[model samples]
Target chain A: MAQLRSLLLPTIFCLGGLMGNYFDRYTQSKNIVAEKASLVTTTDNKCSLGDIPSSAKEIMKFGFPSCENLKFREDYVLSYNRVHRTANWVIEHLTADKVFQRDFKRKSSMFKEDTSVPVLFRSTKKDYRNSGFDRGHLAPAGDHGYSLKALKDTFYLSNMSPQVGVGFNRDIWKRLEEYTRNQTRVYTDIYVITGPLYLPKESAEKDGKRYVKYQVIGKNDVSVPTHFFKIIVGDNRKKKSNAQLQLQVFQMPNEKISKGTPLDEYKTSLKSVEKASGLLFLDKASSLAIATDRSAI
Target chain B: MAQLRSLLLPTIFCLGGLMGNYFDRYTQSKNIVAEKASLVTTTDNKCSLGDIPSSAKEIMKFGFPSCENLKFREDYVLSYNRVHRTANWVIEHLTADKVFQRDFKRKSSMFKEDTSVPVLFRSTKKDYRNSGFDRGHLAPAGDHGYSLKALKDTFYLSNMSPQVGVGFNRDIWKRLEEYTRNQTRVYTDIYVITGPLYLPKESAEKDGKRYVKYQVIGKNDVSVPTHFFKIIVGDNRKKKSNAQLQLQVFQMPNEKISKGTPLDEYKTSLKSVEKASGLLFLDKASSLAIATDRSAI
Candidate 1:
């Protein structure tokens, strides 16, 4: 009986691996179709809207975190959080073709309210004025420098969150964005999902209770997220059909980080981010090749 | 010239009133059809599911707050907030027939996890067990005493929030629920929408900044809302076609409340609740019959 069981184990493992690969491909294709359909609808709404690019389809090849108030832009897509007057999450597809092309300058882009959103829920420039915190971009402006419209779209208040300036947004957060862009040189395609998080912290009173606290800036009451997260997927599609996809998840505190702090220290598991953000990541990917080895970072 | 101006003023007022009434009826009928269609889909899901009751249709006469994760129950319908492990809002259609029927007793109902919700986001009875807060029902069980299944449905953890037990949930909150049921005697139909709110409060440091803070309980991290809100719309449908509809909105803190404090003190404008909750109320209604006179309370 022991010999028979051992013989069956190998066969079962082979079948499971085949099924996983098949399912992953099926899901990837299904998501691409759905995303393309949505982009088509967006194109129909605006006559001047740019052509639907295949890059958008490849970016959302895995799956969407959540489908609510989705704004399909020229270079990226974001789900706006109407209540918080900010984005729930933003998806950006990075490649050597787009990130390397620098046709537009950031100087001409202006921060403006997203007129597509209802006036009642819209966030404005006045809300961020004198509010000490910087209007941080979720889809970094530098990533969309390939097109003038895409660069300007990143400046919408809907894409902005109230982020700390000196030590956080401008310093460590910028480094992370640059690091993500640098990966385009290594991987053929890079898909990124970035969003804010309101995490709970254990109270100081030792009352055995946890509390979530975050400041609201401006009249719109835009929530200053306690933390921010990014999930990066690196795919080398040119490789064999069974080529592994590299996954890396990072979560950073909204406050200041010392200059010497290693970026690897912020790395976290995908499950932790999903639980905290109330969002699921890459569910369509039957198997995630999480770069568990520290050397991968 | 004075005579002409006075005549035009009255004519303009009359025209505005006519348009408002016509628009209100048109919107109301549209909502009814949309809600009925949704109920039909819910019915098709489970063969054993209870029949589609007209009460559920009447409860949602005003359009839904937001359509994300909706759970259509026997007597009440709610939009579940998967992130918070609680209902975004629960709507109950109260009437002289349902609330006063007393066909089911509360003792027979048991607090159980809602299996309909995904296991990752579901809250359990264990989460509330020693959590220092009561499993307060957003749709009060007493409001569904007419049917055994309806009463038991209210016990689902999805319908609960971590509410203060003694001074709040049991004492003042109970009174408010009872008060809502009693309104059925006056109005032919009383539609109540109850939900939790994490309202922002100004900090004590005089820094001129506002913050939202709330406690979370157990492994599931079910949010303990800082406040609760109810929007009560009373309609006397039996009256003339142009009869007015009463609108009353209230918001209460999640902490303790004194016994002597009048419930009227909690009454607030609908606009304030909408702004804070990130929801719209009765947008389909042509005009609100706001009981401006304190005597109406």
Candidate 2:
């Protein structure tokens, strides 16, 4: 049974559940985890084609689910890239298990809470007043074909940003996806968060989604393109009391800061935060997973 | 019966079963999709305390049949997100008609090959490859708490890559896991190919498992540390006939090209196939679900 469990439930994250050294038989398999343990990961079931039924022609496909039903996993909160909670058993379906492989992996239990939490995909259909604003996805759909819910979740109002798909297809957005996934080859267990900045509601919506009118970033300016990054130190249910905690790193064209020709166009931008969370990246993130853990701080 | 099948089997790929939507109904509620399909996502089956079964406190906290063993739908592919596939029934469980709500999901039609595949756990203690290789993971475990098979598949050799886990932590890993799912959110049918780049003469091996090594990107770099990518493209498969067509993608990061800032430091480092096998991102793709629609590309 233990061996079977190991074969069935392959993972090394017992710091939250069950990680076997092979000598021991245990199945520390749970969707949400909190306790004193460690984890190890592998890609045993990474990618392979599934057996198609004789009715392969008859099997139909599903589209995305709804915003009202966008269930957020209480797992980890968004740290960098996009707004995200710890993944749930269901979100696992959004992954391309049979296509890509985890070429490399490493983790830091030494993470700390920071101000910028990257909101990846929330309910794009909902808003901040906790109103009808849709949670937009930093990532887009028509990209992930896992399910109507998973794919549609990518289309959530919260997941929305008013940008042309062609813009993404052409510039940084397209490069970003290819760079991260296509090039890096990372295939699992990553937390992300990406959302828009609110300074007196520049864009509003009826469905409560969002009106992404502009970016805080500018071109050719040294201090151009100032974006916020929130390094979530914990899970979504239990987050730091406020958004002040920040490990916010500002992004700008290097030409501005460093010596370069045609480098005169540089304007540094500033973003205000209620408070600032200390740096968490280069240290202390592993312990937060166990113990009583935490609850939406 | 069509409506029943609509609710029962959501696994068919429409583009000759290549681009069929990949969704497992059990993962998320279709009603949410019917309601908020425009944007945002609502799922009931996101990972949670409920997933920890009450029967086994140590092993199964999220709970279950000790562990859930699943057979690939006739397509051999399994959708754990908001979609699930069944022949002619939408039974949530073998014994119950209850539905499941999942956060992320992968709607698939690629399962046209195998019987139920085994989801394995943990890297083998022994590296048998003697090629300085390690059974790397293709899928990271953090993303798929939703699907046990997704997690276990990370352990498969087919998906393993020679990588070093640094800089990338669980938070990022999880985000990347979800990101990969989202990245693959397109193409009705996608064929991914990956494997080791080379076999070193004196590589280490333990328990029949090889310890693969990948270069450290930013760990040593001061100005721009951790800047590298792993990938290989072009068709490398032995073909039986010229008539056979294949979808080739740069699956994993091979030491040959997957280790540097290819885009920045190495221009012309990337390759273009002139014409991709199919349309990549079709804005509002559903309208083009049919091959003959011809609005995209």
Candidate 3:
């Protein structure tokens, strides 16, 4: 186990944990814009597990609701551990844990929500396997720097689900990640919405064993992700009845016969790190896009 | 209908008509690059379709490849126009009809390859009735200030596709656009690759339609699009190529459970225009990108 650092300087500045408290008080009695913290001190800025405890905002959940039971899918579970300011929810067996640290450049794209991300999977140990599914990784290590934990969390069997790489290997997936990173500059925090997208069992596959792979993927033929999620961390102060930045991550099945995915392409992304994660987010991009649309008017 | 300007001056400068000659000469001779104009006609440059028809090197198609036949299914159609320009290809939409105006605050980005561009949908008709789906736009108008024809061509029924907004009212969408405009000074000709993403049927709908929508979009949703292809207009040449930039837009099945679209949401999109004719060359982004990718790789 790697010893973690305890830097909170960026946390305070980045998360505005202190400001989060101030906003709580400020909104309490219309206290203007709340007390302004000219600067964040390392003291209160640490990303304590307390910050994201069970009570923490379940802002977004991917995989199955049952995965939320924690114990049910302990194998794929990534617990938040503080290495100073960085909170890493780690895994142990990524689909391709070893290929993560290379200097492979992602394709140019408008968004890279899931480029370079590690594929996760659903664990057979969790009773969610064999129904024709795949283990998908919600928290991908490929996009972020190479942290041993980051790589491991990618393989957390519980995090896996059946998924088709929408723009996988292509640029769309990488561009989405870039888009999310860009969001950090303007917003105080970012809440991401990501999950696996399953396909019908008979959509398409290779020799009935290999699934259609993506470009620029790991040793496993899984296409590098083509999509990711991004919900800028906004002040949850209002606890606004509606999600401020809700998003969805999905893997689109290849529609036409020649787009590369063979006919009889698996409608459902497979199961098993050996197969595909038979999982997908509850909704698709359109479902979550409504979150941004204000119904007030 | 608005009569388009002569565009002759730009036509000569951009080498709009010389596409055919350029293709045989340039395509056969793989070592060619877009020639830089020596004349100081620094008529401020912005993103435009001027360079597309003659610039592409490869035309790797994404999604399911279908003939001109068959009804378009938002989730079962092409996913993107992956263009490889020899080490890079800017992913963008081209129209058979000239439309859109490149208006940006700087030159570098406008001149650079596609960087960030969002997928937009323009209805083929005003009323969402009759059409089995909502008119969708692939290249959104928000990214550029194209001419009416430029904008209109983008709304070609062939250009629209099913889409879903990805975030809150996609407030981040516009912000992302602004961010791209602001970041131009830092990078230029950012090779881009953007396209439609099929999430699934009823994947996630706004009111009742499943659409892929976004707040911010870039020219090439990637850090660096691999297959690079481009063409330079030498104020002389003949137009060539038959591949057109097609926009496949789509919307979801309307749900009475949803309120009427907001008045502010009323738009003058491409779907509302009459059929187009002429030297249709604008709708050619994906094709050119494909050429660029092919020649380069």
lDDT for each of the candidates?
Answer: 0.72, 0.22, 0.25
Structural similarity to truth (TM-score) of each candidate: 0.80, 0.20, 0.22
Give RMSD to native, each candidate: 16.4, 26.1, 25.0
Please report, as a residue range, the 10-residue window in candidate 3 chain A with the lowest summed lDDT.
A39-48
Candidate 1 Cα outliers beyond 4 Å, as residue runs: A1-56, A288-297, B1-55, B288-297
- Write candidate 3's Cα lDDT for A212-295 as tens digits: 222211112122222222222232323454545432223344221234442123212211110122112222122333445313
Candidate whose DockQ is highest: 1
Q: Top model by TM-score, which number?
A: 1
For residues A58-108, write the lDDT of model 2, one tens digit per residue. 111111111111223121111121111211111111123411432322121
**Model 2, range B1-297, lDDT digits (tens) per residue?**
743443221211112222222322112222211210000000111111112222123211111111112122211111211110111000011001101223324342111211222111111223213333232333333333345444344333323333434423222322333433343333222222111221112223333222212221111100101112222111112222222222222322232333322232321111111111101111111221222322221
Give lDDT: candidate 2, residue B101: 23
Two-way lDDT contest, 1 vs 3, winner: 1
Superior candidate under TM-score, 1 versus 3: 1
